[model samples]
Target: MVKKFFIFFTFIFVSSLLVSKDITLKAEKEKEYTYKDKFMWLWEKIHDPKSGYLSVEGIPYHSVEKLIIEAHDYGHHSTSEAMSFLIWLEALYAYFTNDWKPFEKSWEVMEKYFIPDKKTEQPNMKYYNFDKPATYVPEYDDPYKYPAGVIYAEPVGKDPLSDVTARYGYEMYLMHWLIDVDDWYGFSKYAG
Candidate 1:
């Protein structure tokens, strides 16, 4: 009778283990399903498809960085950092779902506004000589003497990335350091 009781106890324990295992797996599957839906809505909130950019004041801004900074910046402001996060998140979504559209959309919107057009922004770019990218100035130890001590007389090294820049034909322009999302700080073109 004791042996029979021991076997019955073992059977009950094994049954409970199987039931618990199914519950854990169901929870995991539910979490994954929720995340897939989240990625979809997140893409909708960040960018404007109508204007095809993360826009400001009818002017197309390349990133959503400035707005985030305007909200709260913890003493550091960087558009590249913001863009990096946006791109990374999109890539992660793509990795999980095997969908590249959202990733490509983020990159496209960023480049469309961030990168300066060679024709519009740099009309004189073609005349630029790669051999002399810039005249070098000597470094000085003293802060007061620095400006006076500096001389732009040395020949600069040939620009190594000129070809690469030319291949892409777009110069990155990270400017308007702070984007006033609601025109809160008065960076807007429109005067109130």
Candidate 2:
């Protein structure tokens, strides 16, 4: 009777340990799923391919038509705000879907327009109206007078290194992480 009780107690102890470990692992898996679900929900909500951008803040416009029109009209061609946001969105979408095609498409468009000339090292922020050549349009149509590399905060686009550059730096850091991925965008070490 004593031997049987001892064996039964030992079995119960071992079984409880195994059960607790399984429960912990299950909880961890559930947590991961919950995180993925939240991201997927945001992707569904803010991803607007028709507008060629993500809303970022998840502000809902009246309609998809309105979103597209707003993006087309107000989207900056040169600012890090415009380019980095798009890159971030594309990267997230690709990460979620395991599809690189969308990111690749956006990359081609961004490479052609958003990235400023390395020689000038300035963001010209030229708007490439899809199928048209990237062109800089100053308020007065005087591209030659506009400062080349610095981010201007003033109305005339002349002020350099504005407060918005902080946002740009952050976006660049995110892009560095997103694009540094292997076998996706072709691993390139981003020095900046």
Candidate 3:
């Protein structure tokens, strides 16, 4: 009886340990599944060409360029520039990845609607008038002629004008910064 009891107790303990191990394995699998789902959700939202503009969630590419142009006319400088930059960046990514559908769409919009008839000439002075509001312009001493410091010269009070180059340049810098940061953080583990 004593021997039997010992064997029985050992079996029970071993079985319990096996059950716990299985439970842990199942939990880990579930966790992995959940993480994968979250990743997919984030990836779809960020990279989906059809819905990927900075504002106007889920806007089609055909309309994105028109929207940016209108935004530029309306003096929504930041929004217009950001949308254009994002579209271009997305196009570049799609091209490299051999996903030409989004790239084509973005390019069509850029070509049809967003491309300026002419690039704005750089201001001779480091500073240019931001608007009616009197603000001192910052110096652009760099050889590349990239505008340094704030883009806007002054508050502009109630009135504003869309400085196309300034807006686009600012947006490009910001988008590059964000992509670099994302790469650094290992969020974009795979380079597309």
For model 3 the TM-score comes to: 0.28
Please say which candidate is ahead in TM-score: 2 or 3.
Answer: 2
Better of 1 and 3 by lDDT: 1
Cα lDDT tens digits, model 3, 106-160, are 5554443343323342233224444553544566667576555555645536324
Candidate 2 C-alpha lDDT tens digits along 1-192: 999999999999999999999999999888877656887776665565456333323222223332125333322112345455656777987887898876786676556444434444333433222233234444545677766543344334323433444346312212211221111233333212
TM-score of 1: 0.46
Off by over 4 Å in 3: 1-40, 46-81, 88-97, 119-192
- Please tell me which predicted candidate would have the highest lDDT against the true structure: 1
lDDT values of the candidates?
0.60, 0.49, 0.47
lDDT (Cα, 0-100) at 59 in candidate 2: 23
User: Candidate 2: misplaced stretches above 4 Å?
Assistant: 1-33, 49-78, 116-192
- List, residue by residue over 87-145, the lDDT tens digit for candidate 1: 78779878877988867876774565444455776677667788878777677678876
The order by descending TM-score is: 1, 2, 3
Measured by TM-score, the strongest candidate is 1
User: In model 3, what lDDT does residue 136 have?
Assistant: 45
Give the per-residue Cα lDDT of candidate 2 at 173: 18
